[model samples]
Each structure stands twice: as structure tokens, then as C-alpha cells.
Target: MEFKYSDNDQLSVSSTREKIQEEVFNAKCRVLTEIRECGQLCDVQIRVGEESFPTHRVILSASSPYFRAMFTNSQFVDPNQQVIQLEQVSADTIRSIIRYAYTQQCDISTENVESLLVAADYFNIVGLLSECCQFLASQLSAENCIGIEKFASWYACSELEQIAHNFFMENFVEIYRTSEEFLHLEPENLCRVIASDDLNVKSEEIAFDAIIHWVDFDPIGRTCYMAKLLGCLRLGLFSTYFFVEKVKEHRYVKDNTACRPLIIETLKFLCDLDRYADARSLGNFDISSCMLTPRMPHGILFVFGGWNVNSPTNIIETYDIRSDSWMSCQTAESDYRAYHGTCVLDGLIYIIGGFDGMEYFNSVICFDPVKQIWLEVAPMYSKRCYVSAVILGGHIYAMGGSDGHTRQSTAERYDKNRNQWSFIQPMHQQRSDASATILDGNIYICGGFDGVTILNSAEFYTPEIDQWTLITPMLTPRSGIRVLTYKNTIYAIGGFNGVIRLNTIERYNEKSKAWEPGPEMSTARSNFAIEILDDTIYAMGGFNGHSTISSVEYFDIDNEQWYGAADLNVRRSALSACVLKGLPNAKSYVPSRSRVPIMDASDTVHLKDT
Candidate 1:
């Protein structure tokens, strides 16, 4: 391609390409496989477990460094010798390995992957080894991750080992309860796992329970390790009642005199917290002790890029539920997006259509929480601000929003695999500043401003039918309302009602098909970021009629009332938020051990001298 300028200058603008398609590569591979099958120019016989596999020495030597050294170096092999015997691997595994060497394809399954990986490692076949490890890594579950991690590490498959280790720690509770291999873990590896800062447990009780179970599995050999494992827990985080009643009186602690000092330290820590409960303010207390350092959170709520005082903000913050604190994440300088739509899919956060204060955007940016990077993806077909988005059936639906000039009834569906967005059925009404959520295999979008008036109308879209149907209207007119589905029920919270901001809450009664009253927030807000974590709906920064505010609060099902939580670091409105679960590098998003502070003025609790 050539670019012509008005000044009579021209330049070539093109990308050079040199590549072969998969089918083309496979065609060449098929020739190698066919010749090997025909025994054409065969040079070697690999014998394993009562079976002999004929092969070409050149193919084998090219595919594996082990074979290369054996065939090339006189010190390793004799030129006259044609047969090599392998007793470590079965004939089936050897056959698969030979096939892969010829065709770059291997048949791997759960039953054979482990043994196949051993054969690949022994033979130094990097490609086959990688495929085997990848197969095992994909099959990692709580029940088998510990064994897989150990297996990968023993073979020096560093990438697979790291992934397995991350999964093992992130799902520690599940593995602890379900994995037989965890109970049989060696003391050193067990200590390493439990002591990692990456350990993910909502509470320290799970870690303590794991210790008891692992010790109980082998008391004779593990009794001495009781203190070592016990020391790894954040004992200070345990409730006073639970600590004194359960931990203090447990046989593991009572029977071992070596555990006496740890118990005393925890008691002192609890006593100090109780003593300072009333006297010390949140930030004044020293909370840098190892016993108080929080583990990696099971989930992290991200609040990023919002409309601030006079313009869009470039700020991004993470709320760590376990630590009950917010830490500002250091992100690359990016376009500040406001009124954006956010959806997390397959551990990646997608920031959809938004406004950058100057223009509405159809562009999309994907955030990799694991690698802490940003990338541009395919954009939407229509420019949108105040967009409402939801991920359903693995497809992201960007619903009605303003295109800067007017309210839009247009919608589109994004295919992550194709990096493309195609048209979807528009809503019944043009809506802006609406909220959308997934409930019962359908996408429900609630109240929003339709340019002329704030709307109380609500509707749902069924992907199977590709149509929208009107539902019951809200009890009050609302714009910028936050609607979410929790435990099969839909709750619509704070928003503006044209004349003023509203603090009221109403829930949709599905059977009755009407909006019922729920608890109201303390302060009225609109255009806020809301998400559910630990069974609580947390609402973050939003507009409070006159100005943007940093206040945050929550409403829990068990209490049936609203309660305040820690506020955000920035005051902003029109923000987008989502929670990412089971992130491998969650520790990077959260504050380190030294930076974690136990209390803040926004959220303080009293310890009743227990």
C-alpha cells in the first residue's frame, strides 16, 4: 500500500508477511508420517516394553536433543547399533512420542498424560513435553492440582509448575477439603504452600482447619510439624472467641509445648487489639506484624476511570475484601474513560464503549489482571457513553447508550474469539445511564434517561429468541440506577429521578412481577459502581446531586439493611467496575504485607475486650 500526501510526497505503508498456514504445515508433516509408516529409509528401532518402533535417525535427531547427542557424539552411541531399549516408558507412550516427533501431534488424556510427560522429559523432547504439560495443566482441579504441581516440578517443567502452584494456592480451601494428595504432602512443601503470601482464603480458619486435618492424617510423623504449620496462619485475624475456645484448647496446641510461645503471641496480639479498640483511631494503630498481614484475596473489585470534578480520571483502585482496604493500582497511562461499560470474562476485564470527556467511543480496551497490562481490542459498531453491558452465554452485550448527540436504542454483541462486534436486537426504548445484569439466562436492563425524560420502564432480552420484551416498570422514575441480580432476585438501587437524586431501594418480585421495597442507602447517589462480594452489595463512588462523592456502602441479605464500608480513594461518578475471581497474580493487585493496614477511619470495628 502507498500513501500519497498533498505535498507531492509518497510513502509505502504495508506489513511484510512470511508464514505458512496450519494446513500447509500439516501437509508436510503427513509426508514424514507416511514415509515412516512405509519404513522408507528407516535407520533406528526404539524398543520399549516388548514393542519396537522403527524410525528415521534424522527425524528423531532433529526432533529431540537427546537423540541428537546420542546419534552425533561417539561417546553416547555406536554407529553400528540400530536398536535402543527404553524400559522406563510403556509401548503406548513410546508410540505416541514417535508419532509426535513425526507429525507434531500427540494423543494425550488424563490417564496417559502423566506417564507421557515422564517419557518426554526423559527423552528431552521439548515439543511433546510442552504439549503433555499443557494437557495436564488444563485438567488441573482442586482434587488433583497438588499432585500435578509436584509432578511438574519434579520434571523441571517450570511453566506448568508455576501455573499449577498458583491454582493450588488460589483454591486452597477446596484442595484442602477434597484433595487426598494434600493430606500426604511432605512437611516442607506443605509449609511452603501455607506460608505463601499468595494463599487465598477468606478467613484464617480454613488454614487452621487444613493444618489439623493434615496433621490428623499422620500424627506419628507430623506431630512435630504442628507448630511449624500453625505458625504460618494469621492467628491474629481469628476472632477472640474462636481463638480462645477452639485454637487454645485444641490437642495440637495443648499437647505440644513448642507451640506455647505462638499461642502466647497470638493472645497478646488479640489483647492489644482489644485494648486499642476504643483508644486508637484506625490509622494510628500499628498493624504491620506478620500475624496481621492479609493473604491474597479470593476476589478483587476494580474501580477505574470515571468522571471526576471537571474531567475524566485516569485512576484505578482495587478493593481487597479480605483485608477490607483499597489500594491504588499502578497502571500504564491510558485514555481516561468515563461512563464506560465493564465486564469480566475468563479472568480478563473488558472496558467497553465510553466517553473520554471530548468524544464518545466505540473503542474497547482489555485489561489483563494477571500480567497487569492493557491492550486494544476490536471496537463496537456504535459509539456509546453511559452504556449498559452484561456478559451472557460467553458473549458481551453492549446495550442502549448515548452516542453523544442522542439517546440510542442500538445494541451489539461482541465475540471474544473473533474480536468482532455484530448487531443485536435493540431495546424497546432508547436508554442511557441504565444498568444491566444477567438473570436466569436472560439480560435485564432497568431504568435510564431517554434524553427528554428519566425512565422508570424496564425490559429483558432473551438471546435464544433474539428479542426484547417489556417488563414491569419501577415504582419511581430513575436514571443511572444500579440493577443487579443476587441469588436469583433483582435489586434496583440508587439513581436520580429527574428532580433529585434517590437513596431508595426496590427489588423485583419475579413471581408477582412487581417492584418491592428493599433497604435504602444512607446517601443518595447515581452513576455509581456496584458489585456483590461475600454476599454483600458494595456501592462505590457516585454523584450525590451537587457533586461527585467517594462514599461507599453495602447492603447484606442477612441483615436486610444498609451498612457503611470503606470509601474509595477518589471522588468520581459515572464509573465502571467488576470483580475478577481466582486471579493468579492477585497479590500484585493488592498491597504487600508491609503495606497492608488493618484499619481505616472509613471502616472501623470495635473488639469488645475479648
Candidate 2:
């Protein structure tokens, strides 16, 4: 079709703007090639340490503001000059800078990064300086973070300094133990590191040891700063035994006159746990602000296998209560198993019987968090699912669950000393999906289905007598309930009441032998995991009837309110969870000499058919 043109008509046009950009890029490439290969067009000579680099002054002037100022203003050198000498930077570094000016690219390695960064900053090359900062930031590690942070601060590289400082804080434990630079830290920097609540240490004992190590390395020189450094440690968090055996016994504490008052204050604080507020005022340091409280040790909550929306899963994840973050942990070496029972004893997590969709399992497994590995342990006597296991009197009591064919009232206890499971006196009632918690030296089992009906009956077992006695029943009959002991009171969290999912919560007072109403959960759920960290009860992912959920909420005992926390990465139900004391440190594990099948995040292990 032919178009007629009119004065009022407008038309849109498409143009190849990229072609013009390509032509400009080609011209720049040709100029760089000529300067590099022929050097005939070179108008400036940069002389450094017995070597010289010849390049066009126009390229250098455009790439760096320093060069531009020198050439345009003729401040120190004439634009017509053919050679300039730089004594501060080496020849190799000067050549690299010139190459970057001409080609807009340069290689930075560990050997040359420091020198190159210095030259870039000196020449006022913003792009090269940024590149060097980014490279150094990416290379920050426990071994090199101190040096990088110091260098970045000296050079006024604020972004690089902050990055290096954060890495140093997060990995301070390893750096303190292994890095030579830690001993050489300036007094101010050393105090700042020790004072930080974000330092991931297993305990204040580790931090104290680190301070002592630093002082002992150069005792005479560091003795002057002993009071200042020791003041930063959270001495109140240490036990009385540690203070007596480690702190008071140390030479530094005895020799330093300035440290006596601080030690006395710590002793007073330990004697009276309620003296933190008063001590803080007197000492000018807030003992209450310490990350590890006097009551609860630093720990991570490990959540094990559960059923996802579509199927069961053997995935594991950990929650760092201090950081309030969840990280994927090593998975288990078996088919997806939910309704499993778990308890921590002697630094090992023992996983007991549970269902795996098609069959009830009596199999038991042990997980070493440090080694990040799982090992098979002695299996239980009966095929059980939906069991409740608790560590009482140094033995694992695996109680009431279905055996695929029948609900079990049978029970067994595994003695770690004997490394075997032995039959224990059975409960009065058969129960599955029940909850068990230890209180006042007795194991209390409460609220579960008996394969016939949901029961409200609760019982406590005396290990010495090998007998179970009925206790006060709950207000409501529940299955899949979670029982936890806090402040000597038993809390029954959300669960199913056979008719509907429940948000109702109740507490049992062992001394009074009574059940009292408690604050309800935000959502009604069953088959979830509950853990008490620092007096707050966290209820994580579970089935709400129609679908599995990833939502998590914590019940603050002080405020008597429920608030949301971070959600799980996967929606699941019937998971097992427990809090293991100590900071999460993968390097703490001693490597096993014997070959054992280990399961990691990237790999899965299948159980051998027996």
C-alpha cells in the first residue's frame, strides 16, 4: 500500500542504534590494539622501578581524574612531556593500571591485588579501585579478614572495611583459635571483637580462653590491657566451677589489680542471679545484654524428617535461636519417616521408631551433628510408629505407639552404658501420637489415641520402681500433642482432639496435681514440632487438616502473647525436633577413621533391605 503524506501526520520509525554502539566499540578496540602492539601513537611514558609503560595520554586522562587534572591544569607536569616517573608504585603495577586505562579491564590476583589497589587509588581510578575492593571483599576469610579489614580502614575503603568486619564477626571463633593476626590485633579492635554479641562462640569460656591465650602469647606487653579485655567477656554466663577453676586461678587475673573488682562483681552476680541490673549500673557494663543467658546455654534446634504436602521427607533443618535463622542441615539415611521420636544424650541425637508410609519401623539411628553423619543403632523390640521417646535417668524410654497391627502399651528403655534395649513395664493404656516429658524425676505421658478412642488420661512412670501411675487428666482429649517442661510446669501445646484440630493449650502443675488453662496458639495444628528456647515456646510446621504448613510462631511467656517467627523452607508435619546445646560448628567434628555412609544435603542414603 502507498501512503499519502500530510502536514499533520506523524509516523513511528525503528532504527539500528546498536550498530552505532558496535562501531564505537570497534574504534576503541582498534585504538587499544595500536597502543599495545605498535606503541607508535604513544604520547606519554610512565617510568617505575627500572621499567616504563608507553601509552596514549588521551586514554590515561579519560580513565583517571588525576591524569586529567595533571594534563588539563598543568599542575605538576606539562601535557607536552613525554615521560613521568612514579616511585611509589612498582613497574608491574603501573603496567597493569595503564592496560586497564586503555582496555577497561585488568586481572587482579592475590599477589598483585594490594599493590594494584594502591596504584588505582593514587591515580584516582574509581573503577579500578572499586574492582579491587570487591575482589578483596570476596576473598575475606578467617585467615585474611584481619589484614584486609585493617588495610581497607587505612585506605578509607568504607564498604570493604564493613564487609571484612562482618566476616570477622561471624567466624571469630575459628579466627581467634587459628589466625596469627588475632594475637596482633590492636587493643581497641580486640576489645570491640570481644564485646560483640554476634560472635559465634559455644560459651563465654571459649572467649575467656581466647583472651588468656592472647595475653599469654605476649604477657608483659598485653598485661596493661588485661582489665579492658577481660571486662568485655560475659563472665556472668560462666559457671561457678569455671570461675573458681579457670578465672580466679589464672595468673593474669591474680596479677592484675584492676581486674579484682570485676571478678568480685562477677562472683556477686553468679551468687544472686537477679543482680544483673544492679551489677550493670555499678560496673558500667550490661551483663543482661549478653547473648548467652545464665539460664539457657547457646544452642541450635534441629528439626528432622516429616511429611511434606505430597509425601514424606527425610530432610533436616536447624534453627539458630540467636540469629533467628533456619539453615538446611544434613539429611537422614533412610526412607522418609515421620512421627519419629528423638532425644539428645551424650552429644548424640538418637532417632527412634516411626512410620514410613508403607510400614511401621523399629529401626533406630543416631546423628552426630558435629560430624554431620548418621549411624545405625540397636533397633527397638517391637515395630512401633507415632512413638514418644524421652531421655530420663540417662536412658531412652521408647513408649506407646502402633505396631502396624495393634496399638502398643509395651515399652522399652535403652541404656547407653549397655548399648542395648531392654523391656520395661508397660503403660496402663495403649497410646499412639502421645507426648512425653520428664518432670520431678518422673516421665509423664499424656493424651493420645488408643486405636479405639482419643484419651485424656495422663500417667507418670517412676524409673526406680519400674511402674506407671495415672495422673490428673487433661481438660481435653488430644492426639499428636506436644508436652514440654518449663519452670517445673508441664505445657501441653496444640494438637488434635479427635473431632477437630485444636489451638487449645493447657498446663499441668506437678506439685498441685492440677490442669490449668493456658494461652492458645495462633493456628490450630497437629503433628508439629515444639521447642522451648530461652523461655519462649516455638511451634513449627504441621498439618492443619487440609494441607501441611510452613508457618512458625513463638509464645512469649513474659508477655503472654504469640508472635510470628521465620517460616520453614518446606511445609511438613509429624517432624521431630530438639534443642542441642552449643553453637553450630561443622569443624568441631573429629573425622571418623572408619568408612561410614554419610548423608549430606547433596546426597541421599537408602536403607538396605533386610
lDDT of each residue in 1-610, candidate 2, tens digit only:
1112222112111124656777798798777867566877778788887888877778889899988887787778986788988888888888888888877789999999999898898988999999999999989888999999999998889999988987887677779888999989888988988887556564577778788878878988998888888888867566666677788778888867998888887777666544433332334433334422321224567788888876788778876553345666533333478988999999888889998788889988887777666767678999879999999878999999988889989899997755679999999999999999999899999999999899899999999999999999999999989998888899998888878888889999877899999998989999999988645788999988778998888887767778777788778999988877653563122112121111111221111111
lDDT of each: 0.84, 0.79
Number of colliding residue pairs in model 2: 0
lDDT of 1 by residue, 1-610 (tens): 1111122122111111223466678899999899989999899899986789889988988888988998888888888789988778788988998898888889899889888888899989989899998898899999889888888889999999999998898778778888898988999998988888778766777788888889999788888988888888888788777788889899878878989998998887787776654423545555677787887677888888898889999788989877777888875334598999999888888889899889899988887777667777788989999999999989989999999898998889998766679998889999999999888899999999899989999999999999999999999989989999998899999899988888999899888899998888988999999999756788998999999999988776776767777778889999988998877577777777676656422234322221
Deviation from native of the Cα of residue 423 in model 2, angstroms: 1.2
Q: Give the Cα error of residue 275 in candidate 1, in Å.
A: 2.6
